[model samples]
Target: MTTEHLDGNALAGPLGEIFAVDVTTCTGRCASCGLTTPVASLHVYGPEPGLVARCPGCDEVVLRLVRAPGAAWLDLRGTVCLRVNLPD
Candidate 1:
């Protein structure tokens, strides 16, 4: 069977709970492939062990988020940098 996945836009709700900004609109560069794209453009999978987002260019994992009781863990080592837009 094929593994089904969703676009990073799915992260909005989960990430919104943690950040004040819309993180899905942020651009993140892949540490593995150096491809830069919006977080909303990445491929996302899973909500069981948490969410895993991968780069569209190389399919390398760019972000991972795990939520537990009263806490959330976010791993972004696969991402070189994230560009978040701020309102002036």
Candidate 2:
């Protein structure tokens, strides 16, 4: 089966609920290919089982978010670092 995906901007709503700032603006480094880019540039798929964001450069899974009844799970193992901008 073919899987269609969206840009990481789709994660704005969900991620906004958990983070104080806009996560889409954050820069992420892929652990696999060492590619670094804005989270908004990553490709995102799914919202049913959860959301998975993959690196655009190497197509490696960069981030994963799963929401349950009262809890949420986020996996960033594929990302070495996430640089989020903060107000001074």
Candidate 3:
């Protein structure tokens, strides 16, 4: 079976809320592949229970975010680190 997917741009809004920055332009290192790339280049799936972002290099789940009524959860286990250039 084929699962539908979208680019990381879809996550910009939700991630912006959590990061308070433009995450789509940020770079992230994939823990599984050790590859560094722009977050906006990753693959994104779902607005169902939450949003899932996967690495384009190794297909590893790089990030997962869930927003509840009064709470929110963010997982970055699959990402080693993220590089964001904060504005001056």
On lDDT, the leading prediction is 1
Please write out the lDDT profile of model 2 over residues 1-88, one tens digit for every residue: 1368899999999998889999999999999999999999999999889999999999989999998888889999999999999999
Question: Candidate 1, which ten residues in sequence have the lowest lDDT sum?
Answer: 1-10
Candidate 3 residues lying further than 4 Å off, grouped into runs, are none
Q: TM-scores of all models?
A: 0.95, 0.95, 0.91
| lDDT by residue for model 1 (25-87), tens | 999999999999999999999888899999999988999999999999999999999999998
**Residue 10 Cα positional deviation in candidate 2, in Å, after optimal superposition:** 0.6
The alpha-carbon lDDT assigned to residue 36 of candidate 2 equals 91
Best candidate according to TM-score: 1
Candidate 1 clash figure, as a count:
0
Q: For model 3, where is the 10-residue window of minimal lDDT? A: 1-10
Candidate 1 ranges with C-alpha deviation above 4 Å: none
Every candidate's lDDT? 0.94, 0.93, 0.89
Candidate 1 TM-score over all chains jointly: 0.95
Candidate 2 lDDT at 40 equals 96
| Residue 12 miss distance in model 3 (angstroms) | 0.9
